[model samples]
Target: MRVLAAMSGGVDSAVAAARAVEAGHDVVGVHLALSRAGGTLRAGSRGCCTIEDALDARRAADRLGIPFYVWDFSERFREDVIADFVAEYQAGRTPNPCMRCNEKIKFAALLERALELGFDAVCTGHYALLVDGPDGRELHRASDAAKDQSYVLGVLTAEQLAHTYFPLGDTPSKALVRAEAAERGLTVAQKPDSHDICFIPDGDTRGWLADKVGAERGQILDRAGDVIGTHEGAHAFTVGQRRGLSIGTPAADGKPRFVLEVRPVSNTVVVGPKEALATAEISGIRATWTGAPPAAEEFDCHVQIRAHSDPVSARAQWRSGGVTVVPDAPFDGVAPGQTAVLYLGTRVLGQFTVDATVSAVAVDA
Candidate 1:
């Protein structure tokens, strides 16, 4: 089998590419230049697609004795991930750029180009499993539950899964992958894993949004529709956010306040008690299935709203092109523009971007 190993210049990806070569497949290592920020080097494991990262990926490929190349996809990334991120926030919604990258750039664009170039599969270092199910290949959690990345990959379509390959899915831990890289004489063995969003170098999301969309001072409304405080821009806020809101005044109940809603139309930031973030229902859009869409119109399933949050029990109602999930109990922080991945046991049934939420507690605008 001819495979294109998508090396991310990290220990996990180096070991994954080595494993792919060890499996007797014809493999080629390819580093994606997604950032293309004047070829600057990444510092402290914060930036992705930096010149240093590309060099590290090349070094790993040389150690593995495979052909290596860098594929530039910065324009696509800016349009699909970065631009979409700013747009979503400007519209008073929270967007997950990592999920967007997987959906648009990695799995979709790269996979398509790989197929066109006569590659049988596009391999990555993602910690997620592909198991044969009753219907076809089904995605599952990795052996290392803590490092499972199946959530971000929830936006993958059935066609994308047909050619997707995760070589590190069954690895017990990331440490072991680094150890394997050491054994294979790869240089990325001790490279620190990136934790922050790639584009936000300093990790100041509010500041970045502020720079993008200039400050527009607006009223911060209480639950009773009365102005409590003022904020620079509503685009800098997301539903359920607690910190960074300089509300100036505390809630009458003396409890910590949370952002209940961000109204872009009214240019208002609504703040109330943290309990106001609790939601009972979530409506999702742009649903994509890993394999086949469920034939049943409605069913009980596990819904994962956040990447690291535990999957909550939910009753899902399948709509024409999307699904509405009602949690068995109240769920907090059901933010819009986030992916809601659905699962039936360990198998990923599908996922959709959250567009609307119905909180258990009523919130005022």
Candidate 2:
């Protein structure tokens, strides 16, 4: 089997490429350059697509004696992931750039190019499993639950899954991969994991957007619509954010208030008690399924709203191009533009972008 490994200059991907070689498959290493041009390394972190990372990937390929190359997809990445991220935020929604990268670049563009180049499959170091089910190829969470990345990959189509491989899915811990790299004398064995979003390395997403859109002064209002403070911009805030709000006045109950909503058009940040954050249902657009769409109109399943969050029990109902999910219990901080992944046991049922959620009803006296 011929495999094209997407090496991100990290220990996980390095080990993945090595595993492919050891499995007796012809392998080629490719590092995706997602940045426009060479930029200074962000403080305290070496993000992906850096010159150092490219060198590290080359060294790993040399150690494994495999063909290696760096593919510049910076333009496509900017259009699909980074630009989309900025646009969504400007519209007062939180977007997950990692998920966009996987859906657009890795699985769509890169996979298509790999097939055109005659590779049988494209491999990655994602901590998720691909298994052949009775229906077709199914994606599952990785062995390491804490590191499972299936949520971000929920947008993958069935065809993409058929030609993709996750070599590190069953690996119990990342520690094991580091140990293997040490044994193999790989250079990335001790490299710390990439932490910040590749494009926004300083972790100042607001700063990045402010530079792009120009900060606008806005009013910070309490739940009752009374102006409590002032903010630089509504885009700088997200639903349920508490810190950096600088609201001097306390809530009626003397508790710190949390941001409840960000209205872009109104340029307002609404604050309220934490209990106001609890929501019962969510609606989303752009829903996608792995295989055939479910036949049932509504069914019970587990739903995850954010990466690293435990799946919550919920009932899902599919609409025309969206889905409505009602969690068994109220969910807090269900933000718009976030992915809502549905799971049926270990398999990913489908996913959608959260548009809105149903407000909890008040009890009658």
Candidate 3:
């Protein structure tokens, strides 16, 4: 089988590419150039696709004795991931760009391009499994729970899963992946993981957004609608954010308040007690199923609200062009725009982009 190994100039992808070569597949390494600016360097090890990174990927390809090319996916990435990110926040939703990248760029555009080039699959270093199940290809959690990336990859459709390859899914740990790179004579074995967004290497999301969209002065309001303080911008605050509220109106209990809502219309930020963030039900938009969409309208399953969040037992129902999730108990911080990945045991049933959440108060009402 011919495979396009996405070498991200990191330990994981370097090892994954090596593993593909060891598997006797005709593999070629390609590092994606995601950023538009060529001169700007990545701040520390927090960014991806920088010139240094491309060099690192090239070195890995040389060590493996495989041909490598730097593919420019910058325009597509900007339009799909970065632009959509700003728009989502502007609309008062906390969007996950990584999820968007996986959904739109990697699995969709990259996979399509790979197939056009006659590659059987596009391989990545994502910590998730692709199981050749009794029915067909199925996505599952990685063997190493600590590095499981199934949550973000929930957006993958059945077709994408069929052409996707995660070679590091069965690895015991990230430590072992680095070790494998060392044994394979790869130099990225000691490189740090890129923790920040590829575009914003410093991780200053607020500063980045402020530069794109002017930071509008907004009112910070309490539940009663009384203005307790002021904020830099509604886009700067996300649901469940605790710090930077700067509310001068001290809470009666002296406890810190959390962000409850970001009203884009009136440019207001709502703050309340943490208890207000406890939600009982979450509903999602644009649902995509991996195996089969559930037969029953409502069924028992586990729904993960965030990428790093724990999967909570919930009751899911297909309705109103979305999937409504009713947790077995109250769960906190079910924010809009986060993908709700559905799971049954180890198999990923499907995923939904969280559009709305019913708070515990709303549930009781």
Better of 1 and 3 by lDDT: 3
Give the TM-score of each candidate.
0.97, 0.97, 0.97
lDDT of 2 by residue, 1-365 (tens): 99999998889999999999999999999999888675665445545778778888999999999999999999999999988998898888988888899999999999999999999899898999999999999999999987888999999999999999899999899889899999999988998888878887767778988998879899999766789999998999998798999987776689878887889998899887778788888999989998888899899999999998889999999968679998999888888988999999988988999988665632210
Expressed as tens digits, the lDDT of each residue in 1-365 for candidate 1 is 99999998888888889999999999999999887673666678686777888899999999999999999999999999999999998888899999999999999899999999999999999999998777888899889999999999988877788898899999898888888888889989999888778888668888998898777989898888899889988998888888888877777678898888899888999888887788989998888889888888899999888889999998998877688999999788788888899999887899998889887886543
Root-mean-square deviation (CA) per prediction: 1.4, 1.7, 1.5
Give the clash total for candidate 1: 0
Residue-pair clashes per candidate: 0, 0, 0
Off by over 4 Å in 2: 361-365
How far residue 191's Cα lies from its native spot in candidate 1, in Å, is 0.3
| Poorest stretch of ten by lDDT in candidate 3 | 356-365
Give the best candidate by lDDT. 3
Relative to the unseen true structure, what is the C-alpha lDDT of residue 6 in candidate 2, on a scale of 0 to 100? 94
Kindly report which residue stretches of model 3 are placed more than 4 angstroms away from their true locations once superposed. 362-365
Candidate 3 per-residue lDDT, tens place, 135-207, comes to 8899999999999999989889989999998999998899989888899989999998888778888889999
